[model samples]
Target: MELEALHQVQGVQGSSYPIYLGEGLLDDALPNMIVERGYTNIAIATNETLEPLYGKPLVKRLREYDSYMIVLPDDEKYSGLNTVHIIFNQLLLRNADRSTVIVALGGRVIIELVSFVGATYMYGVDVINCPTTPLAMVDTSIGGKGAIDLPQGRNLIGTFKDPIAVFADLQSLETLPVSEMRNGLAGIVKTALVGDPDLIDMLTPDDQSRLAYRPERLRTIIERAMAVKVPIVEADHTGLGERLHLNLGYTFAFALEKATGYKLPHGEALAVGLVAAVRLSHRMGLCDAALVQRTEQVLQSLNPSNAPVSYAIPQGRAIDVWEAMRHDPKWRQGKARFVLLQGPGQPIIHDDVPQELVLEVIESLADGVYPRPRSWRMVL
Candidate 1:
C-alpha cells in the first residue's frame, strides 16, 4: 500500500502529519499511517451511520494487522461523556495499549470521540482522523481540539490532541445528506471569512451552479477550505493565537447551535452565524452594509428555503437558543464572543460583542424583520 500523493501538515506543536485526500489512498494510506506512526495495535472508532458503509472496508484493508472497532450510535446528540465512556470501555476490553492508535471513521462526533478516547487512554494515544463528513474534513477533524458535550455546554469536556494523520475521502461524502453537505460548506465560508477571501469569491453563483451536482466542485470547495485552515492550524494548532480567528464564524455558529437546540447542522449554524457576524460587523461600522447584504445573498443562493431557521427562530424558541448561547463554553464571562468580518478573507475576533445586538438579530430573523430578497426565490 503506497500513496500516490500526500500533503503534509506542519503542526504548531513542532510535529507534522500527512493528510491524504485522494481516491484509494485509504488502502495504502491507512496501513502505512499506522506503521509509520509506530502504532502497531489499532482501534477503529465509528458510528452506526458509517460503520457498514466504510468501516468494514477499512477493517478488511487492515485485516493483516491486529485491530478492533468500537461502534457507537449515530447522531450528534450522543456525542458526550457517556459515548466517550463506551469508547474507553471498548479500548479497555480490547486491552488496547499505548501502542494502539484510534482511528475515527465518521463525522465530527466520531472524530471527537476517538480523539477523546486517545487523549485519555493511559494518559494519551495516537489518533488518526478519517472524516466522512465535510464539516469534519475542513474544520473539526484536523485541529486537534477533541471534545465531548457536557450538560453545561458544547465541547465542555475534552483535550487538545492532534491526530497522527487525517484522511479526507471525497467519496465518503456521496452518502452524506444534502443538509449535512450544506452544513460542511459553512466551515468553508468561515475559512473564507477569516482568511482567503479569494475562496469566498470562488463560492459564487456561477461556481456553485456548476458544482451543485458535480462532485468535483464539492471536492474543490472542501480542498480550498482545508487550505485556508492549514496556515491557521500551523500557526496555532492549540488555537492560542491567529487560530482564534478561526473561531470568528465559529462563535456565532456555536450560538446558533445552542439557540436551535442543536437541531441545525454545524454548517447551517455557521451560515446563520456568518450572517449574524456580518450584520454585527455592519452594525459596528467595522464593514460596509453591502458586504453583509452580499453575504446574505450568497447564503440565500446556497439554500434559501432553509436559510437556517435559527436566524429567525420563533419567539417561543428564541429564549431557549439565547440561553444556550449565554451558557456556551466558547463565550467568556457570560458574554458571547463573535468572529466579525472586516472584509472577505479578513475576520476579526471580537470579545466584547453586545448581547442586545445578538438578541435583536435573533428577533429580526424570527420576525422576518429583514425582508427576503428576490435571490431567495432563485435559491429555492
Candidate 2:
C-alpha cells in the first residue's frame, strides 16, 4: 500500500516515478497511475505466455482508454533485434503516438523488450512496468536499464530509460511455474551476496517450495532484495560506479547462456555463474575459501539440482566461453571487468584476472569440477 519514489535529477522529467508493491493492486493502481500521468492512449507490451494471465485483466480494466496489446514471443532467446522490430510494427499498427503510454506486463524478458520499445518509440514514451515474475519485480522492473540479447552475448543491446511507474503485484506470481520462481531467486541471491547480507538469510532455506508456500515471507525477501538495488540505481543510474557491483555473477552467466545456445534460463545459469565467480574470487585471494563454500551452499539450497552440463559445452571448450566474455557489455577498454567478492557484502571489481585462472575455472565448470555442489553426481 506504500508508494516509494526514486530520487529525481534536475532537468530530468521522467527519471523519478512511484513504485507500488502489494497483492491485488492491479485493477485500481495501474489505471490510476496512467490517468495521473495524463496518458490518454496506452499500448500493452507482453508475450504469449503472460498475455492471458496479466495482460488480459489489464485490458479489461483499461477499457476507458484507447489501448491495444502487442504480444511478443515468450522465449528469452527471442529477446533480440527482431523482437524489437515486431514491437515497433505493432506500435505503428496500433497508431501509438508519443502521447501513448506503454504498459509492460510479464517477466524480465517481456519487461526488457517493452522498456526498449518505450525508449526508442518516437524517441520516448511513458512506460508502466507490471512485473509478474520475481526477477522483474525485485531487480529489472525498478531499474530503467532495458536490454536485448545479441548473438554474441546476452543484454548486448540496451538503454537507460525509467518507467513512469512500476506496479509489482505479488498475486500475479501465483500463476508462475515453480521452475520460473527458482530462476528468479538467482538474481535475489546475486543482490544479497553483493550488498545485503540479510537477503542471504532469506535465500538460505533448504526447501525451495517453502518460498512459494509462504507468500508473506516471499514478500519480505523481495523487499529486502530491492532495498539493495533501489539506492544503488538512485546513486548511479548510468552504471558508472557502485552499480557495476550488480554485475556480480553476470560475466560467467552470460558466457554460460551463450555457450548453451540459451537453452538455460537466465536465473538458473546465473546460479551456476555465482558458484564459478566465488571460486574465482577465492583463487584470486579476493575472498576467503569459507566465503566460497558458504556462497555455493546458499545457492545449492535454492536449487540442489543445478550442476555443470558436460554436453552443454564440449571438452576444453571453455576457451570458447572465455572468448565470449570478451564481447560482454561489461568489457572495458580491452579487458573484461568482473565483480568479485572479498566477503559477504564486500564486492570489488577485478579486470586483471589471469587468463590461465579464467580458463581453469571455465574449464572446470565445463568438466563439472570447480562449481561442483554437494549434490553433484553428474546426472547427465
Candidate 3:
C-alpha cells in the first residue's frame, strides 16, 4: 500500500486538519504523533470487535501516554443514548478531560460514537480518529458528521464536528473479512461515480475480488476515494450544499435499513440503493438505460459485501421504506431529494422526486443476484 498521502480538510476561517493515509500508522506513528503535538492524555475508544484484535495492542504500544481504553458495544442497535451514557461514565471515571484526545480506533459506528463523545465531552475535546474499515476511512472519517442512532431511526442525534486529524491505516484491514472489505467498496464505488469517474476504470470485472487483497491497487483506490471527498467537505462543512452529493444513493440505502429494522449491513444495503438511484434516473429520462446496466455490472463485480442484497422489499414493507424516505434527513421540503446520475460523473440533485416513481425504482432493483466470493469470516 504505497499510496501514502497527506490531505488537508479545510475548516472555518481558513483553518484545516491533516488526514494521514498509509499502512501501519496506527500502532507505529500515531502515539508519537499525539505526544509530539503536546497532548498530555489520550482516550482510545473502539468497539468489542476491534478491542482485542487492534485496540489492546495499540494501548500497550502507547503505554507511556496518559491513556485509557473505552470498549463500546459492537452492534449498531446499542449505539443510542444508553451507549452515550456508558461512554460518559467511563470517561468521568477515568478523569478524561479537555486535554484528553479521544482516538476513535474502529469502524464507522465506534468512530461516530467517540466523535460525539469527543464533541460533547467537557464542552468538546479534540478527536483524532483512526478509521479501520474501508467505508470509514473514505467516508465517515472525513466528514465531521458524528452521529448516533435513535430508537426512532438512524443518525437522529448528531453533531458536525471534524476530527483534529484522521489516520487511516491500511494495515488494519488485514484482519477484516471479505464482507467488511465490500462494505468499504460500496463507498469507494460511489466516490468514483460522484467525484472521480475515472477511478471506476480500475474496478474491471476480474479485478474486483483481487482488489481486496491486492495492497497497491486497494490503497490507491482508498486514497483516490478520500481525495474525492475533501474538496466538497471544505466547501460545505454542514451538509446543506454540495456535500449532499456525497449521499448519492443513501436515500434508498437508509430506507432499506429502516424497513428491515436496521438488520441489513449499511454497505450491502447501499449497493442496492445505488442500483435504485441509477434506475430511477433512467425511469425519469434523466439518463439512458445504459447507465443503469453499467452500474449493475460494476456493483455486481464488487461482490459478496456490495452485490446489492438479493432483496425484493416486500411491497408492504416497501411502503415503510417510502415513509422512511420522507423522514430522511436529506428529504427536502415535502418531497424526496434524490441525487441521481445523469451519467457516470454527472450527478443531479433533484429535490422533487415523486413518491410513485421512487417506489417503482426501488422495486426494479431486485432483478437478480450474482454469487459472492467465499468470505473468510463474518463482517464485524
Model 2, residue 258: distance off in Å is 0.8
lDDT of 2 by residue, 151-260 (tens): 88888888989887788888987777655676677788898998897678767764535543567887888878778888888878878799899988899988887877
**Candidate 3 structure quality by residue, lDDT tens digits, 140-216:** 99978888887667787888888888999888888886657777877888888898887876764453345436777
Model 2, residue 293: distance off in Å is 0.5
List the global CA lDDT of all models. Answer: 0.73, 0.78, 0.80
Q: Find the candidate with the highest lDDT and give its number.
A: 3
**What is residue 263's positional error in candidate 3, in angstroms?**
2.1
lDDT score, residue 218, model 3? 74
TM-score for each of the candidates: 0.89, 0.90, 0.92
**Over the stretch 1-380, how does candidate 1's per-residue lDDT look in tens digits?**
35643458887557887787865556666767676666557888888878888888878877778777888888888988888888888888988888788888988888887888778889998888998877888888877888888765677777888887888887887687666667666667667777677776666565435444456666777787888787788877766678778776555667667666776666667777778778888887789988887777676656645343335677666556567676555567776666677777777767867667766766656534222333321211
Q: How many backbone clashes does candidate 3 have?
A: 0
Q: Which stretches of candidate 1 lie over 4 Å from their true place?
A: 1-6, 35-38, 207-211, 304-310, 316-320, 367-380
Question: What's the lDDT for candidate 3?
Answer: 0.80
| Deviation from native of the Cα of residue 87 in model 3, angstroms | 1.2
Clashes of each: 5, 0, 0
Q: Point out where model 2 deviates above 4 Å.
A: 1-15, 206-212, 304-312, 366-380
